[model samples]
Target: MAQRELVCPEEMAHLVERFNYAPAVKVGQMVYAAGQVGRDSEMNVIDSSLEDHITAAWENVGKVLAAAGCGYEDIVEMTTFHVDLQEQLPTFLAVKDKFIPRQDVPPAWTAIGITELTFPGQLVEIKVIACVPDAA
Candidate 1:
């Protein structure tokens, strides 16, 4: 049986100490990360241009991935929730290309369009699942 372990990196300790939730959970070779939005290190939402908004979200996601000892290449799946998908896709995809690995077969991705998110002035949120060899 694979044992479940809380995978919280010191960089994201606020998630556990303040938010009362692990930024990500690790079980054996798999890791499930929480959705990451384009907020500051202190979690304050940022009001910025479309590219910057998308960039920040991916940066947060990268922090979560680092916490799990994984890289973008280790990501097997990703899901994103957007407040304005149609309007943001081009900029979002452009920014995504900068983060996601250019693998022969890329990770599975699903994007959802929605009206709003948990916070005001937020634009995008992304979460990912990574599968690594001997990750535990």
Candidate 2:
């Protein structure tokens, strides 16, 4: 049997220094990523618009996937949380199209309206699961 590998980003290393949570956990070929928000590399919120935030969050997801040696195409599932689902749906799909084109196999996704998030201004949160070829 092989040991599962845990992956964390340099930014997440700073997070682990201040908090406690593994960014992603890999067991065999599957990777589970934590909810990612719209914060920039410095951990500062970058955009207030729904479109901007959604784009930023997905970009962050891409970063995490890259850190784990994966990509959007490798993702099999995604779950998104939003404060205003009806109002944000259009923007979300628009931003999503920029990343995951219709020609590609879009990951199975779910969007839920939430009452609140950890941050006051955060309008969106996203979590994803991905898989890669087994190393062993």
- Best candidate per lDDT, number? 1
Identify the runs in model 1 with alpha carbons over 4 angstroms from their true place. Answer: 134-136
lDDT of 1 by residue, 51-99 (tens): 8878988988888888788878888999999998999999999999999
TM-score of each: 0.92, 0.88
TM-score of 1: 0.92
Task: Report every candidate's CA lDDT.
Answer: 0.87, 0.83
Q: Write the per-residue lDDT of candidate 2 for residues 40-119, one digit (tens) a residue.
A: 76678766677788899999888888889888888899899988888989988889878875645778999999988886
Candidate 1 has an lDDT of 0.87
Q: How many clashes show up in model 2?
A: 0
